[model samples]
Target: MKILLTGITGQIGWELQRTLMTVGEVIPVRRNEMDLTQPNSISGTIQQVKPDLIVNPAAYTAVDKAESEPELAMAINGIAPGIMAESAKKVGAALIHYSTDYVFDGANTTPYTESDKPNPQNIYGKTKLVGEQAIASSGVPHLILRTSWVYGLRGKNFLLTMQKLAQEREEIKVVADQIGAPTWSRVIAETTAQILSQARHHVSDFLVSKGGLYHLTASGQTSWYTFAQAIFAHDVQHSERKLQNLIAITSKEYPTAAKRPAYSLLISQKLSNTFGLFLPDWQKTLELVLSE
Candidate 1:
């Protein structure tokens, strides 16, 4: 099977390159080759590749910066996926797209499900929700996997930021109120591979039966403050740590351009029920990532 994978340079995409090789003939597309910001580039690339499966992990992910550049963010995150889906439909291909938990308002105490009505609180979340909707409405066989607090060894994420701050600063203040699961990128990629590999018949047929919106994230939930503490505890370079104090603060303590959800924990039971797959707890995934 031919699989066209976008965002090859991203953390999840990088891991996907390793995990998806066994599933199909992977065609990795970098940003320059298939920029999500350009609609023609998106449709053009899909038309050219014409793969059986199009896995898109690329998006304009700067949450705060997206407030300032809503147009660019919307162009990439909102408009591109629809074009990709339309193009995929033209070529008889299925799509696997990644979304975020921010699609919800974080107003609920319980974990979010696939059927939950999304009320995005910020521009980034709003755009991602638009992307998910576009794919769903485009009549393309697709899977919209919503995840939260994604971090990996490579890329600018919470884990690397904490490690860098630990080395430079004596004290670190993380948001204590906001809650979500800290999912490793490799887990997302590996799970995607598993989903595709589990295809009993044709790839498109598999997606037709199982494709829809599903939450895929690490098993457990924690606040940013607790997650930072866990990171410090399991950090491989513990000896180089200069962090003496890890302070817990409210969302108001450190204001941002975007309004983040206070509680955005997504329930992955649908994914588990459909695919019989489950991700490790956040703590265990963190340990595995740090060890690697």
Candidate 2:
């Protein structure tokens, strides 16, 4: 099977490139090779590759920056997936795209499910939601997996940021109100690979039957303050730590250009029930990544 994987440099894409290799011949494409913001680039790449599966983990992910760059963000995060879906349809290929928990406004106390109505509070969330809608309407065989709080040893994510700040500052303040799983990139990648592996010889038919939206995330949830505490506690390189305190503050304490969901924890029950794949708890995954 031939698979066209995008965002080779991203956190999730970096890991997906490695894991997906076990299932098929992986053709990893960088941004320069297949820019999502360009419709011709997206369509032309798919047409050239003619892959059986097109796994796209690429998007405009800057939360706060997206407020000022709405057009650019919409082009990538909102319009790109629809174009990819259309392209995939022409080639009779299945698509797997990653989405976010930010599609919700974080109003509910319980974890957000796939059936929940999305009320995005910020530009990033709004754009991601639009992408989800596009893929669903394209009539293409696809799986829109919604994950949250993604981090890996390599990307510009909360995990790396906390580790960097731990060594540079004595006192670091984090928002305690926002809650969600701190999913490791490897877990997401591996789980996705496992699910696709089951499709095997009948990839498109499988996706057509089980395709749609599903929440894929770590088992447990935590706030940014607590997540940072875990990072420090499980730091393999403890010698690099600074002196003082890890302060917990509300979202208002540290305002940003975009308003984030106060509680965006996603329920992975649908994913598990459908694929029989479950990601480990956020804490366990964090420890494993740090240990490695």
Candidate 3:
């Protein structure tokens, strides 16, 4: 099967290239070839590739910067996936898109389900939710995998941020109130590969029975402060440092342009039951990434 994969340079995309290679032809589109900001470029490129499956992991992911650059974010995260879906439908292809838990307000104390209403507190979430809606309405077979607090060894994420700060700074202050699962990029990619390989039997049947949306995340939850502590503790060099100086502060103390969810943990029961796949705990996944 020919699979057109976007965001090949990203952490998830990079891992996907490795995991999805054995399954089929994984074509990683070049940025210049398919600039999401240029709307026409999306459909035009999809038409040219004419892939059997379109897996889009590309998105304008700058949370804080998105406040100042809503248009660009909306175009890439909000508009691009819809165009890809429409094009995929035209060619009788399937789509697999990734979303975030930020789609919800994070007001709930429990895990959010696929049926939960999306009330994005910030522009990033709003745009991602828009993409989800667009793909669902496009009448194309699609799977929208919603994840949270994604991090990896390569990308600019909380794990690397905390590691760098721990090694460089004497003290690091992190938001202690905000809570969510920290999903590792490799886990997401691997799970995606597993689902795709299994769906090969009857792609249309899989879409009809198990498409739409699913919450795929690490099994457990924790705060930023605790997550940082875990990261420091996981790495011997960083752990030996005066991590005692690590301070826990409220979200109000460390203000940002975007308003984050206080709690956006997602339930994976649906995904587990549907695909027989469930990711390991956040801490376990973190250990795997750090081991590298």
Q: lDDT (0-100) at residue 268 of candidate 2?
A: 94
Per-candidate Cα lDDT values, in order, are 0.93, 0.93, 0.89
Q: Using lDDT as the measure, what is the rank order of every candidate, best first?
A: 1, 2, 3
Task: List the candidates' TM-scores in order.
Answer: 0.98, 0.99, 0.97
Off by over 4 Å in 2: none
Candidate 2 Cα RMSD after full superposition onto the native fold (Å): 0.8
Better of 1 and 2 by lDDT: 1
How many clashing pairs per prediction, in order?
Answer: 0, 0, 0
- Tens digits of per-residue lDDT, candidate 3, 1-292, equal 8899999888788889999987788899979989988878988888888888989999889999999999999999999898889999988789999999999998898999988888999999999999999999999999999999989988789987887776677888999999999999889999999998887746656786779899899999999999988988788674545545889999999999999999999999999999998789999888887888
Displacement of the residue 103 alpha carbon in candidate 3, Å: 0.6
User: How would you encode candidate 1's per-residue C-alpha lDDT over 1-292 as one tens digit per residue?
Assistant: 8999998888899999989998999999988898888889988999999999999998889999999999999999999999999999999999999999999999999999988899999999999999998999999999999999999989989999999999999999999999999999999999999999998437899999888989999998999999999998888797898989999999999999999999999999999999999889999999988998
Model 1 quality (TM-score): 0.98
Against the true structure, candidate 2 has what lDDT?
0.93
